[model samples]
Target: MIKVGIVGGTGYTGVELLRLLALHPHAKVCAVTSRKEAGMRVDAMYPSLRGYTDVVFSTPEDAGLGECDVVFFATPNGIAMGEARALLDAGVRVIDLAADFRIGNVAEWEAWYGMRHASPELVAEAVYGLPEVNREAICGARLVANPGCYPTAVQLGFLPLIQSDAIALDSLIADCKSGVSGAGRKAEVSSLLAEAGDSFKAYGVAGHRHLPEIRQGLSRVAGEPVGLTFVPHLTPMIRGIHATLYARLVRDVDLQDVFESRYANERFVDVLPAGSHPETRSVRGGNLCRIAVHRPQGGDTVVVLSVIDNLVKGAAGQAVQNMNLMFGFAEDAGLGIVPLQP
Candidate 1:
């Protein structure tokens, strides 16, 4: 069994990882760290994990993480870079579910995340953990940087277009809306139910942190810098991200066939039938991105809709997928969950 250690096991992403790993056949939870919640049973804090995990939260110093086969940092951005190097040196594979090593340019990452990167040297070595884009790299990587929730949905939506050079690169747009859980399990006035509930508005219109990460990923895929307008909105729901992507066609190509053929073999990315509108709820609680393609009146503009459970495919589930690849397990081993429905 692959012994696993998790840092910052109190947040939504941490518990989501625990919940998913509990069902994984070849993985075992060896330790979970939380400075504030040390000594508390993980299952006690998150009852959903009650019968699945008996691991207790401990301080990072006492977690014995060096002995685990792999360690997942579900902590905030700055936390991972400060600690991943040590773990990697000890022969433990590291997966950071934060922005610490996602961006290739250190100065650019610092400007957006607003912190001096703790381990900039490792940034170049850390593989970006978007399985669809970096599967081979992740397989051989000792350190993996998991993509953010918004970037996951947006990049996946525009991937086929960019790869095929079918879209006007300079005019790409990602209009995304995500559930409240995307903010993380923290107390803030903006995230309060009283304030965010019953409201539909966009934030980070000027520029958001995920913008550069999305651009970086797409640019790498397109082999050139692509102009993109990424705007993210906070929805009233609790999970999932719906990204409505737009791009002008540079050439005539079957939009449906393009998306379908691109993701036909991908187990997690579902390309719905032509003219279908995928709902966020369809991917809720599962590591799946359901997409649909359309052309308005056979116009030059193409609209692609992509949906994913922000905490699942957008975060924890994708991390698990990377772990599976790194360790040579089935990609869908622990992620075969059916989406939750009303």
Candidate 2:
């Protein structure tokens, strides 16, 4: 079994990893680190995970991550860079669920994130882990930088069109709404129940950090610079992301067939029936990403709507998928948990 260690295990993504790894057949969670809540039993902190993971949270200094085959950093943006090099040098692979190594350019990363990268030299070695697009690279990668939730939905919804030159690259706009949990497990005043419940508002319109990350991925597919306007909103729910991508159709082609043909064989991505609107609830707690296509009234405008469980497909589940690829196991191994449909 592949031993796994999770740094920052007190957060939403970290606990989600433990929840999923508990049932994973080929993996074992060995260590979980938390600087603030060290020495407390993980299950005592998260009663939902009781009996599944008995390991307690320890301080960062006490985490001997080299004991595990892979380590997942579910901490905030800048935390992973400080420890990634040391861990990888010790032959322990890393999968960062933060934004530390997602952007290819160090300057652009530093510009939006407001801090210089901690280990820029190792930036050359980290692979952007989007299983559908960069599967081959993730297989042998020692360090994998998992994509953000918004980027995951937007890119999957538009990648095929961009790759086929069916959509204009210069005029791309992605409007996405994510559950309150996407803000993280932190106690932010803005994410409180009163602030988020029954109220919806967009934040970081012009300069969201995920903007560069999305552009880098879409640009790679379009083979050109993809300038995009990405706006994200906070939803009332606890999980899931719904993204509506707008692009000008470069050619007069059936948008339905375009999406259908592209995702025909994809295991995790599904193109819903024509005229069908996908609900975020339909994919909650699962690794599935359900997307739909629409040719709006405007002749050149196409709207692509996609939904996914922000914590699952967007984070923990994707990390497990990467682990499976790295270990030569089934891509969907231990990740086939069906969506929780009520």
Candidate 3:
């Protein structure tokens, strides 16, 4: 079995990781770290994991992560950077489900994240773990940086157009809305039911952190700088992200065909049939990114609608997917979760 250690097993993503790995045929959770909750049974805290995992929460110092075949950092940004180098040097592959090594430029990363990058050298070695764009790189990477939730949906929605030069790169808009769980397992008042429930408002119009991450990915595909206006909103729901992407058509091509062909071989990205509008509920609790492309009035504007469960495809499930690729297992191992419906 592929022994796995998870740092920070207290968040929504961390528990989701445990839930998915429980069904993995080739992997097992060896350690799950939480300094404050050390010695507490993981199942005691997250009752959903009652029978699958009997592993108790261990302090970070006692996790013995270096002995594991791979370690996943489900902690917040910056936590992975501090321990990744040591784990890698010890021959334990690392996958960070945080933004620590996602951005290539160290200065830009520090500026946006408001913290010093602990290991710039490791950042150079870490691959951006977007299987669609960097599958080859992820296979041999000692450290993999999982893409952010908003960035994942936005880039997937815009990729086909940018790669084919079918749309204008000068003006791209991603009007995305994410459920409150995307905010993470925090106790802040803003995340409370009274504040986030029955309420909807855009929070990061001024310039969200995921803006640069998405721009970098799309610009790389377009072979030039892209002018993108990304605005993210907080929806009342508890999961999923719905991104309505707009781009001006610079050339005429079949948008539906383009998307379908681009993701034909991708297991997680579901390019819906022509004239279909994908809904967030269609992808909730699943490791799928369901997208639909549209052109209004057969005009010059091309619109793409993309939906994904913020915690699954956008976080832990994607991390596990990376692990499978890194270890030469089936790409969809432990990630065949069907979307939960009403």
lDDT (CA) per prediction = 0.95, 0.91, 0.93
Query: Which candidate order results from sorting by lDDT in descending order?
Result: 1, 3, 2
Q: Which runs of model 1 end up more than 4 angstroms from their true locations?
A: none
Looking at candidate 3, the ten consecutive residues that score lowest on lDDT are 333-342
In candidate 3, which residue pairs clash? none
**Per-residue C-alpha lDDT of model 2 across residues 174-237, encoded as one tens digit per residue:** 9999999999998899989988899989999868989999999998987789879999998899
Q: Give all TM-scores, in the order shown.
A: 0.99, 0.98, 0.99
* Window of ten residues with lowest summed lDDT in model 1: 43-52
lDDT of 2: 0.91
Any idea what lDDT model 1 has?
A: 0.95
Query: Which regions of candidate 3 deviate over 4 angstroms?
Result: none
RMSD of each: 0.6, 1.1, 0.7
